[model samples]
Target: MKDFSAEITYKTSRSSGAGGQNVNKVETAVTAIWNVMESAVFRFDEKLRISEKLKNRINSEGLLQMTASESRTQVQNKKIVTEKMLDLVEKALFVPKKRLATKPSKGQIQKRIDNKKKLSEKKENRKFRF
Candidate 1:
């Protein structure tokens, strides 16, 4: 996997949770900001695809943003945000292959019809009327 770390910009702020006094004093939370329009890593079409696919995550300024504060330490949180940003971009650019149309073979269709007839006959016979 190509590391797109060069394309990202990180900001730090004081985060909440799990650290003693450090939580209030130190900036542990990491926010990764990547400008989709400015990134040279991807082509124009791929950038468009990423923008459209991740519209909710992208801001008005066209920067894709992700934040990580789950960890108590700055390094760990930075790792989390970077990985998350990469993963989100990877998923956004993904396009699934189109499936070909298929039909049941003649024998399989006949067998299905035969089974339906058998079921219908069995149910009809179960109606025990004089």
Candidate 2:
């Protein structure tokens, strides 16, 4: 929505990767947490939709959490997690168009029957009658 950054809080930890000494010395991994139940960026209905759709990512306390550790810097990882959370929230709020059920045309049904009869008659003619 319109910048939910204000509602997001971050936690950082040491990242595990091939960063050598840097990985051991610095806390590069970042986790972005947002309280879906207490968010002011989204309306009540939108918040409910986000909670329902992102239930897997949300904790029992109704907080949505995302972690990013791909990069070797805290700033990059923080940005990554924030972007991820925003993208997820946006996806959860999306409503797909309803699908309508339809049946095949009469012409299509006729074609299937015609093909079946043609094969049956061809096999019948192959019989040996003396």
Candidate 3:
């Protein structure tokens, strides 16, 4: 997992979901922001890869924001938000191995052609002779 200690910043706000009575009164939810531009963890290539993958998630200023308010307690919510942010960063940093281009096996190709021939024969039987 990529270390994101320097990459992340956090803020708190009132939670809007779940807890009924206490929800309105307490500011328990946490909003975590990871500023990609300021992070020392990402090398130039890694940064570019992350930026491209997270194009939709990042704001115009390039800050990735995550909010969690599941629990009524501020600390719990903070933990949730941080966990989510870390997961996002981990996913963004992951590099999928390149796939080798391959053609269908001869047997599989023959099977597909046979199926098409059978289907065409079935359709031909449905038509009426004029």
Q: Best TM-score goes to which candidate?
A: 1
Q: Write the residue-wise lDDT of candidate 2 on 26-122 in tens digits.
A: 9999989899989878889988888899988899999888899999889989988988888888888999999999999999999999999999999
Quick one: best lDDT, which candidate?
1
Stretches of candidate 1 off by over 4 Å are none
Show the colliding residue pairs in model 3. Answer: none
Candidate 3, position 14, lDDT: 79
Model 3: residues with Cα > 4 Å off, grouped in runs = 107-130
Question: Candidates 1 and 3: which is better by TM-score?
Answer: 1
lDDT of each: 0.91, 0.90, 0.84
Cα lDDT of candidate 3 equals 0.84
Which of the two candidates, 2 or 3, achieves a greater lDDT against the reference? 2
Local error of candidate 1 at 64, Å?
0.7
Q: Identify the superior model by lDDT, candidate 1 or candidate 2.
A: 1
Q: After superposition on all CA atoms, how large is the RMSD of candidate 2?
A: 1.7
Model 1 lDDT, full chain set: 0.91
Residues 1-130, candidate 1: write the lDDT tens digits.
Answer: 4467898999999998788999989999999999999988888999899999999989999998889999998999999999888888898888999999999899999999999999999999999797
